[model samples]
Target: MDNKEYKEYTAADFLNDPDFLLWCLDPDKREDLFWSEFPANHPETFAEFRKAIQTVGSVRLNNFTLEEGEKAELYDSIMSDYRALCSRRRLLRRRLFALAAAAVVAAGVVVPALLGVFRPPTETDASPARASEIRLISGRQSEHIASESASIECAPSGEVRINGRKIASAKPARMNRLVVPEGKRADITLSDGSRVWINSGSVFTFPAAFGEGERRVSIEGELYIDVTPDPERPFIVHNALFDTRVLGTSFDVNAYCDSNRPASVVLVHGAVEITTGDGEQVQLESNDMFSLKAGNYTVVKVDPSQYVSWKDGLFTFSSGTLERVIAQIAAYYRVEIVCDPDVRELCCSGKLVLFDDLSDTLDVLSDILPINCRIEQRPDGTRAVCVTARTN
Candidate 1:
């Protein structure tokens, strides 16, 4: 069945699907991954899909028997509940607008207003500078670091230091945002003693001092973090796609919002619980890598060091495709890289130390592989790197 057809499925439709029955009866790893991630990809059908799963599980475990007449009645009941939920949501939306309107009248304000009640929560105010600079933003103040690579320290007292010099002092409850542009990186020590290595083209939003409950931070792009243990309060790393919760763990998260690449989390030590966009939860152990690509997800065991080595100025891979390797390099340097089709699938295994100079790194790469690299300047004032088969 076409995957898109599942979006419009009802509980009855799911219950009648042969593939769904197979998934419940004999679960395959690849099938399980697809089914588990289905609800996350199609959130509007989550309730119906969950109801179907529960019904199947109950019948299998409890040996529940239902006649055809009873089955029809159950499907009807499920549809009625779904309709009621939709109605309630519409009513709540109306009520919210009413409240907003009443507040505006009471304030004696006649201004036009656009209420974003249905908008998703995001760090919309934190805007990073250009790719050539690293910026730290707190409240109305923005500080730009002068170095290509930077060290940032956040004290428990809400004091921020950049490259060993005091930069800004924030309130305990205030939020601080750090932006690492392309071709640059930053190492940060949080107030809770946890350490985070921010990669190029990343934005990290965190509180100066964590509150009484959870130690939460949000990110866009990639990061390698070693969280400090606090049993009383869990640490949560939030992205647009999922949330990673851990008490104390070292993990690498590659969650760049690029459509061509998948978002992944690789655990180095300790354990973590991941909650996807549609509220599905997944648990991972040490060395477990969870990858979500195009709404489907898989969990696999891998050498965690291979994924986290970028923080150490190295690109470590084993039989990685040339196309994938070049993609990483392009993102790191914030340059456009195009690979000829013939050489794109070439496989190689080794380590490349990412040098500060792009030309130097390209030279090493050319020496290791049968490829030629050329840099060209575009009219838009950006550079592009083209890779092709070596003529030699």
Candidate 2:
């Protein structure tokens, strides 16, 4: 489609177009046309979208109400989708070609967006950018990938490592994200000898080697860093949304693109200066935090132990609302959690144990929080569970 034609289209237009919506929602759509231009910048919105599709795929529509063998027909329909996806790798291997634009070898059978092609849109401010923009992602506003130059360095002896290889002075590669998903995490030592423990769902990217300049890295999700201090090369954590720059410090960043209300940076030790994507900047002392909320940032002094208890396998929420708490639990334990108005309205204080299994944590919460809850299998059974209840 031409730029003129695409400009006239609205999100609602394609949303209402069943065929287009299916293509948009098609888990296999070519990412070149959509994914990078749309979803890459808006993780939360995409997460919700994937959740809705999962809901639709698993929703229990009464097939038993249909004619005798109709139930089997419905089952077969779902099974066919599974089989098709399983055959993707095999088919991709068989009919593959090299493209000039995409240097990487590809089958060209799987759609681009669905296979993980991400790109920024052309018009940065276009509300709900066209499906084929180049710079900005619609839905959620994120800081653009700013500051491409940051170097790495070496301290005392060995400092950083990459892909199982150790470097005396580590210079991270330039990338938008360093995805260390579950079942995997990264361990890197900075020139300051400060170690970084990257959790699952985390990303970290920097130059492969730092030079005669500042040490800087950009990231998202969650990471625990122990900085090795070089008075000259200050370590800076840069994100489109917020930037935390410091020299020789330890801290954790949870800028998961989860919410706009507040992007958090918890300082463990030393001093750091935080700058927001909006150009707002603040300096945080050891044990203090800079939280970006609603165009403004609030600095709060906190205990380092609270921010990093997750490293030891305990998740804690100090006087946070139910929604944020559930988000943390869902990510930590890897489950979809939804709360009712009442449950969402509930505010939780103190701590919760995640590694102990879901039932134990639920038992502890239900016992103390005056809310009795239970999980029920959805009508359409695709390993879906919903938890609901009210204050006793």
Q: Which sections of candidate 2 miss by over 4 Å? A: 1-177, 182-186, 318-324, 331-336, 341-351, 356-385, 390-392
lDDT of 1 by residue, 198-293 (tens): 987789999998888999998888899999999999999999899999999999988876666678999999999999998999999999999998
TM-score of each: 0.66, 0.48
RMSD of each: 25.1, 20.0
Off by over 4 Å in 1: 1-129
lDDT of 2 by residue, 180-262 (tens): 43322345555445666655445565443455687777765667888877888878887658888887878988765545225
Q: How does each model score on lDDT?
A: 0.74, 0.49
